[model samples]
Every structure is written in structure tokens, then in C-alpha cells.
Target: MSDEVHTEAHGQVAEPQEKLDPEVRARREAALKLVRKYGDPVLRSRALEIDRFDDALVDEVRRMGRLMHDAYGIGLAATQVGVMHRVLVYRTELEGSVAALVNPVLEWSSKDKESSEEGCLSLPGVSVEVERPVHVRVRALDERGQPILVEASGLEARVIQHEMDHLDGVLILDKTSRDQRKQAMRALREALEPRPAAA
Candidate 1:
């Protein structure tokens, strides 16, 4: 199963992704948010499927979107925000905005795959190569609880697969080779280290 994980993703490649909508981005900036970094116990946990689609669920999705934008991340997962629920928000390139999905299930993936660089909000600065299906079909519920089926390829395909992996406690480090994982670990360690206070 791990062998199927891909390296290339939809957005924020080796650089930070800029917010598309200024008004929306301004509102998002006003929202205080936090993203769970590497070594956080929450990031290691498998998210629970969201069964109840109520106001609380809606709030959660909105909050996730705020955090994703705040972190300049194209994609974010429930686990990344310290919520162990199978939910995620990603900025759609076509729509130029974020979309929230709950309990996403990958129904199909193409045999042809590609490899590319991916960075996670949870992992901070480390970007590793990932190989993923160029095309995929997923079934999920919108934040408002409407059923939706997404057929995506290229970047969108990569975004869905990447966020879905997080729901299962899978990180880019887990999907990479041993050497890449080592580099990721070392970077994480450095990020965790205490820095000298400025005078």
C-alpha cells in the first residue's frame, strides 16, 4: 500500500504559494490558526471518518481553510490541525479557492504515474519527491454534507491523493525512500531545536 504513494503534488512545490484572492486572503489572514508540526502525536494518528455533518463540521472545515492559507499551504488535513478527523481543505487551481472534503475515499487511480516535489505544512521546510497517479477519482462529502465525486488529473489529482494520505497518518516522509526520510528527519529535528534569543 505504501508503495503506491506518489511524490509529485498539486501546489506549493519548492516555493511558497501565494493566496489568489486578496479579499479572501485578507479575511483569512485575520483568522488565527495553528498547524501541527512533525513529531506531534496528532500527526501520527489515523483520522476518524466524519459521520455527522452539522454546524460543527462546517466550522471545522472553515477553520482548516484558514489554517491552510495562513500557512501558505495548498493543502491541509484534519490531522495536521490536531483534529483526528478524516477531513481536509485544498486550494483548487481552477477555482482559485479552498474546498473542504470529509471522509474522502479514493475510488480509482491511473496506472500511469509521475514523480514531483512536495512540501507539507506539518513538515515545514522539507520538500521530498513523491510519485502519484496522474489521474484519480474520489468520492467525498462537501463541508455542507453534499455528496460529490471528483475526477481529477495532474495537480488536482495530486492534491486529493496527498491530503487523503494524511487522513491515514501518512506523511511525505513515510512515502519517500529511506535516504529522503533521513533528510526529512534531520530537518524536522533542526526545526524542533531551540534557537538563541535575539538581543
Candidate 2:
């Protein structure tokens, strides 16, 4: 294992990912819309297998990264954005570097599991305690469509498992304890309730 870093940049690396072809970009932007809870059903269905790594898919992945940043989110799955492709954008720190994983699969995980508070963008104003592996190894494709392997631990592992679950039609709620899930749902309902118009 080398500590040296790879100095490389993808077309969609920076903030503004070349807003080419205004009309086409706009349409793709719309297609990249975040799938809000109770509004999008694909979020609960298994994502379709990704067979092609074309420009369209790359663009969508980039736009999804942008959307995640725009919404102040650290991770997002393809199904959450109405794309049934095996894709996910994730970042470890808030407002930090973002990475995209295509057709990701967890190849291994440690037996030790730790519990932590987890939340999802789709389920706003709700957090649940969930237990997940302390470490994981995943095989996926990089932004450049190159195969890559990642070994993550602690929070990184947690985020990876969370996003990977989305690809398999699983949510944090499903992993939470029965009691915690119930409480989270109640709190979510309260948070989403509309308040009376201002006097």
C-alpha cells in the first residue's frame, strides 16, 4: 500500500462541472432531482444493475454529487434521486470532499458492530440508532469509470453501509430497533406537520 496520492481530476471533479449544453444539462438536472420521502417509490425498490458507464450516467453521478452538496448531505443513492442505477455519492465530513461509487458492493466486513445515530435525507428530521459493522471493504468504480477497492472503518464504514443499503432497497429505519424506529417515525411526523399560518 502506498501513501502517495494520485494527482488526477475528472471532468466532473470541481464545483462547476462544465455546464455544457444548457438545454441538456437542465433536463438532466431535473432528472437528478432528490427523491424526497413519501414522494418517491423507487427509493424502496432494488436498483437496476448498471451495465453501461456512458456519458449520461457520468453526468448524472456528477449532478448527484452537486445535489448532495447543495442539500448539505454527505451521501446519496441513485434510487433516492429516481435513478435505478447502482450509483452512490458519499463524503465523510460535512462540506468536504465527495466521491462517487458505481456498482458498489461490500466485499467484506468486520464482525464487530457498533451502534450510532443515523439519518437519511429522504427521511427528514429523523434519526435512529442503528448497528453496523465497524469496518468494510468495497469494490466499485471510480468517477473515471475505473475499478477501485476501498477499505473503510468507523464513520466511513457506517456511511458506506448506509448508502449501499439504499441500492438494495434498505433504509436505516429497517435496521433500527423496533422501539427506536417507532419513536423516530413519531418524531418525523411531528417535524413534517405544517404549522398554522403566521398571524
Candidate 3:
């Protein structure tokens, strides 16, 4: 018997995750390839906030959305794609569409916390348990450069927090206990190592 408790979202009855668009798949492949694995120097620096808000910024953000989707990631930060802008993108069909938040500010969060399993596109096959606020309020600029506030709970809140952490150069490995971190890092390191071809 499974030891873990399973819910609708976490079980076989769960809704099928949305599929990535073809153009987005091609875009992600042609450009903005996800920097999978940890320890890349670019993933260690803080991201710059979006200030100019021009057509170029819009194009970058758009690419990010396609990248995130085609990479099969529910959320992605600009830093993960080798960009230093404090931009993030995420989506769920239930939420309507892919959304980008520039220079997001975590205005507030509930004191209540929950530990959940999370995986990252950048981490590639690595997952870790993370404790996070169950609810959060974030303020950010939309793709059109319009100001907006986001109130999220449950999985949505968790996804927002995870992506936002990337702006500060944080990763899922940093969110676990020491032992778990050690184990995960070892596994990640093994995955990063090139495998020998069959004889």
C-alpha cells in the first residue's frame, strides 16, 4: 500500500495537464533552451527587475511562456532560461491561460504552511519536498505592462512561490532538509554526468 496520502490533484483521477503548443515547442527548441541541472553560474545571480517595458521585453516574455510550456514546466523564471530579467511565467488550463509576471512582489502570505513535492524543469528528474505558505498575494506588471495583483492559494500559490524564488537564485534543493539535500544533490550530480553508450 502507498504510504502517501493522495488527492484528486495528486492521483490518477487528476485532470490531464495542458499540452504545449507546437510553435511554442519549436520556439523552445530553436531558442531559449532550458538550462537543465544545477550549479550553472548564471543560475546563481540575482535577476534584474523589468524596467524598460518595451517591445523587446514583450518579446522576451512571450518566448518565456512558450519555453515554459514546451519544456513541460508549470512555471519558469527568466533566470532559468539564461535571462537576467525578473520575469516569470506559469499556466494551468484551469486558470485560463499562460501568464507572465514582471518584477513580482510577494505582498503577503498566510502564516499557515504546507510541505509539498515540487519538480523543476531546470532540475530535470529531481524533486524535493518544500515547505511554503498556503496562500500568497503578489503584485506585478502584466505582459502589456499593466499593473496587477495576484491572489493565489493551494497549488497556484506554491507555483508562484517557487518561480519567484528563482528571481533570487533559489532552487528546490535549497528548500529541503540537509540529508534530503545531500541525497538530491548526489542524484542530480549523477544525472548531470554523461552516460556511456551501449557497447
Candidate 4:
């Protein structure tokens, strides 16, 4: 759920903000403003199960969807936005419609696993290669509180697992190789470091 397209060609490097269209850049900036960054305490805190399904919940889902789209992310978790509710919004396909899942549970997962590169909006500019199940069945409630079963494979399954990790305060860094974790930590530190004032 990084703020950049998830593709082999793009890999770890994100497109320079200056290279983006003005409007698109502005939207991304605005969306990132609402997302909790790597060092944010909220990003490490596990979310609580959502108990209420009201107008406010619906509104929050809508906001998350818009933010995900604007940030060029495939998925987003409530914790990523400083919300403690166990909710997530995602769209596996770049041009697909977004779906909201509340209190999602990983009902089943295939023994087959695959390793792929993953990025996070919270840890922008950092990508980690992690292994995950190739197929999964999730039981969750829709935004409206209705029970829903999602059987997904491939990219969809990966996206669901990624978002689920966010709910538990587990990050890609935690599941990557030691060297990659060290590299990601360095990048995070540099991102948090203060820059010299313009001369």
C-alpha cells in the first residue's frame, strides 16, 4: 500500500514529486498529510475491532478510499490514518473499485507461498521483499455491517494480507530480510532527519 505504483519497473525508487503533474502532486501531498508516517506511534499500535457501523464509520471509509486513490496506494488501514478501528480499504486492480472491510479475519490461507516486493505509505521510499500466502479466504463485515466472505488469490490475496498486517501493527520491515530491514531503517531515519534551511 505504498504511495507509488507497485510494479517491477518502479521497484524501490518512487517517482520524484517534481516529475508528477501539478494537480496529481498536490493530491498526493494532501493525502500523505492525513496518513501516519513511519515514526508515528499510531502506526505501531494495533487497531481495535470496530463495533459501530454508523454514518461516521461510512464517512471514514469513504475518506480512506479517496486518500488511497489520491496517494496511488492499493490498500490502506485505519491505523495508517490514526484511527484505531479495525478497518481497511483496498482495490487490487489499479482501475478497480475500492472495497471496505471491517474487522477482517484471515479465515484460510493456502500452503503455497510467494515472495514479492512490498511498500507502505507509512514508510514511503522503502520497499521490502516479503513472503506471503498465494491464496486466502477472509471473513469480514462490509462497511454496512453485513457479513461478507472474500476468497482471493494472487495480488488480491497479497493486498488483503498486507492490510491485515497493519491492523496488527506489523510492518513489512518486520517480515523482510535482515539486510533489507537495516536498509529500510536507514531510509526511515534519513526521512525523519531535519534538513538544512534553504540558503
Show how many residue pairs clash in every candidate, following the order shown.
Answer: 7, 0, 0, 0
* Model 4 TM: 0.92
What's the TM for model 2? Answer: 0.79
Cα lDDT of model 1 by residue, 18-82, tens digit: 63367655654343236777888887789998778899989988877766655456788888778
The residue-by-residue lDDT of candidate 4 on 131-193, one tens digit each, is 999999999999889999999998788888988999999888898899999999998888767
List TM-score per model, in order: 0.83, 0.79, 0.82, 0.92
Tell me the whole-model lDDT of each prediction, alpha carbons only: 0.73, 0.71, 0.71, 0.84
Stretches of model 1 off by over 4 angstroms after superposition: 1-33
Q: Which pairs of residues have clashing backbones in candidate 3?
A: none
Candidates 1 and 4, the one with greater TM-score = 4
Q: Return the top candidate by lDDT.
A: 4
**Cα distance off (Å), candidate 4, residue 182:** 0.4
| Model 4 clash tally, residue pairs | 0
By lDDT, the better pick of 1 and 3 is: 1
> Candidate 3 — number of clashing residue pairs?
0
